[model samples]
Target: MIDNSVRTLFLLKHSPYPPMGGAPLRNWQNIKAMMQLGEVAVFSVSSYKSPRSREYPPGVSLWKDYSTGDILKERSLIRKISDRLWWMRLYGYPEADQFYGDRVAQELQRLLVEFAPNIVVFEEIWLYRYLKIIKPYGCCLIYDAHNIEKSLRRDISVSEHKPPFVSSLSGIKTAIIEGYLVQQVDQIWVCSQQEAHLLQKLYRQIPPTHIVANGVNIADYHSDRISHSLPTDGLEPNHFTAIFTATFSYYPNSVAAQILIGQIYPQLRKFYPNCRLILAGHSPTPYMKESAQEDSGIIVTGKASDIRPYLTAASVVIVPLLKGGGTRLKILEAFAAHRPVVSTTKGAEGLNVRDGEHLLIRDKVEDIVAGVCQLWSDSSLGRKLAESAYKLVQQEYSSTAVRQQVEQAVLQLLPSDFRF
Candidate 1:
């Protein structure tokens, strides 16, 4: 007989609270959904350790915070060097912030015995190594593939024009690891059907997969409707403000910011001098800060406590991402906020939104500029698009719709007689 009160342990690299990007927002929403089904606890490493670290999700039964330093100290000098080299060569990121292995395994072992969770959900592939520890416990393992990481890296390699030799080696290693993990996990959760199909082609032994597209917390956005508050600082009164929000640390988003200020803004300025561009998100690269300082019309809000104020203030939101995997949560947020969006075709890739009805989709610089200009010039058109997008989000991408999918998927993995 299946247990009615099932328990889950969710593992992620970073705390899902204070979500600033697409992936974190998904993590946050997924965790919220998990709580409604049964008891839930989170295991995560601190991105930055502090005495004043805030509690996430408020009333979770357990929240364990591990340190990267603990993991590093357990490795030999040569091993550390080798790992550093591998990370740099594979992901082009030298920092070992997201790496977890044997050092974490011991703590994980203790947690597993104490929690005795029936289900263990990993946030992404990087946490796949933990499966070794999880397997002996016989807990059902779910690998939430945020995107086909191997393919995403390959795209990044090609986009950044990495050396052919380096790209080939990285691609081979990534594929081998990802393929191995796909075979090991009991279930694989993907964000889109396209990603699921792609993974199946890439890995012949792929496990049963489910599509759980990222959703917006409609309440988070709707709260804005009730509150007419705007940020006291960092926002200037502009006649027409076109805003783009993305975590600046990501290469694609950083490139998009550059494109916005460099390529698109020039064309846009020719027609509307009073218009301004706002790039808001965490970790503003030095180049972005420098570019913003150089151009008076561009405002870079490095990071903000809340994004709704910016969204509420935007005349139009733009998603000019050139390349990335998975659906864009930013678009969903725009829709929830009832803000008209102008995005590149790639930006709206996995969303079930119509271009003309929900948001405008444009690819080239000229077309992107035209879309934003059209929205700014035509308030009625913007209102229609925003209203349509909001309705679509309410019916499709709302937390209620997505949480049900998650609940069914979780139940399917549980014992046959499992009750709510």
Candidate 2:
């Protein structure tokens, strides 16, 4: 019973067509779930040049797509700085003005007038800048909190060894912006209960919050359907392989990749000489690329179009993240692919799974290496963990589960008399 009359619009910071990384994947999944509710339109503004695809996800009407790079190229340096200064004075942060220019605002206003959406969903906190434009439209507003930005910024600063004063200021500014954004929205959608609780603790007079957990497409990552072909070189079918996949541009993932190369893999090779390490994802750092070149056993696959091949070739998936906010979608992908995972406590945050029951939870370098080696020596242990994890994904973190959550949360915001 699809309702054609219920128009819902999504405001995104990036296009989710191909969904290469976590944020885009979540956006894509959220868009798909919203399609079940009514007519859906997306307006995305990308800060960088992303690879565009002709084949978009079915059932989404792309109202407008803009690239910040293209928009700002012709603008004068003085003008850009002026805009930033003006935005900082008004909003306490210049990110909104930095990402969206006058042209973008004009076009967005035109979309609002024509589309006349019944509901407006802001994909992430960055889009909070457009709230002023959206409020007058009289549409129900939903803010999707991808992460508690303040906490995430603080974590990143600490991990990157940023100065204490700089980190504190950044955190404070983010808290002020995010705190205001949450209070303005009709309802807030968070990735986990932990995030919902954190929001409640941080902000006062916030709207109703719902936990719509991050999910993976079960069919896409099913063990039976994944290909055996390795996507990168330096690995064979017989080689014991460990894989870590993420958008390496993200500060946390980049840090984890450094730890894997600098600390984990070297120790791992001592235990298993045939061991191979693969870092598969987009925007890997130059350090990673150089290390891959220097070490024959390490393969860094940049911007994988499809990750299933790498996952299929992996003996175990590793997530040694020291700092992160949301649940790891990469872990769920590995679970759906029927691969054993070894992660730190921070890496497995927000997920409802025991350390020894679903996957090995190890924080120390020696412990992680030992866990991987134990799995290597005893195939039964890996299979047992993988089986349990696969079942967990099916029950709690699959696309179907997420869609149901989204439907329930969104429906609660609609008027009692409204029907689909």
Candidate 3:
């Protein structure tokens, strides 16, 4: 039987199930937490046209939107051209997702009437256009600000100077959209205190914003010992291994890998000649694969079914990300596995971790080299940092810890007399 009390309708940009780390993991945890408050239903867009998988929270409902192919087949050339022109004029770039079609809007409208939720929560700001449609229902609106979208785009532009014009325009478009949404929503949920402060400063008129930190399901990653794997090359078992993991589809992760292979690894190898590097994640670029072929010690494991094995096999985990926003789930995963980590300042942004205490934070080439060398050389230090990091993750970044904060934030958005 469905719970009649405190129904919430979620609008998501992507499905949370079969969590692939990053935004999906965060969304899955948030939705899981929302179920504790009351019944929840999710409406999301599929990035591709794959067979739908049913792996959501128990008792919660899910409705998926179509991929681009489904829409383009029905869309007329003139209409498409007109949309492109309109997008260019208004947002200074052609953003296809913003104005997809009436089909999605109609579907959302139908679901809204049927579900009749007391609270309508959106995962990201991209879905704000549908906000107006939910207004007549009198449900409280909540915006889960994953990251300040404008700031993220601006940061990318500053870090990687490619497509500067599009990035600048996209940043402006995001700012305009975010500014409007912040005022309209009843409350906003940010991932970190840094994000909360940034949003408040950027939009002073912003409504009550709550800090709901990103977290991991600790049980999924805890491993007692590093999994043993035979050395593929002439390298011995004693070779120091450092692993960097992330979906390479994201631009920042790819850049981070390049930096790791090109700069950080070289420096570290000078101090420890037997040091090996592992790039593990989905969709490894051609360059990454080619680089791996060039160096026998550099191993690229593209799209592993179980990242835990790859993570477990490593002596140290490194995040050399030069750009990106929000707290990193990868770092939290490493901590959950009780693995020592070395990361850049930007890589550790928004995380409740301290430099030299829980994880090593180093930005410069020399510092990163030194950090990795120290972690690999000093077994005692590695164990100490890993233990402290695991405790921190359990206490602060565990699902239970984050869910309570989420629940409180959602409760505050409801009427004082509202009951579940």
Q: What would the per-residue lDDT of candidate 2 be over residues 115-216, giving only the tens digit for each residue?
A: 888889897787777888889989999999888887898788877777787677667777777877888899999998988888888785789899899998
lDDT of 3: 0.79
Report, for every candidate in turn, its global Cα lDDT versus the true structure. Answer: 0.79, 0.84, 0.79
* Candidate 2 stretches greater than 4 Å from native: 1-4, 49-55, 74-79, 83-90, 161-163, 228-232
List candidate 3 stretches off by more than 4 Å. 1-4, 49-59, 86-93, 96-99, 161-164, 224-239
lDDT per residue for candidate 1 within 335-383, as digits (tens), equals 9998899999888887887889999999999999999999988999999
Q: Residues 167-261, candidate 3, lDDT per residue (tens digit)? A: 66778887887887888889999988899999988888788889888888888775543344433343345538899989887778989898888
TM-score computed on alpha carbons, candidate 1: 0.92
Question: What does the lDDT read for residue 338 in candidate 1?
Answer: 83
Model 3: weakest 10-residue lDDT segment is 226-235
> Model 1 clash tally?
0
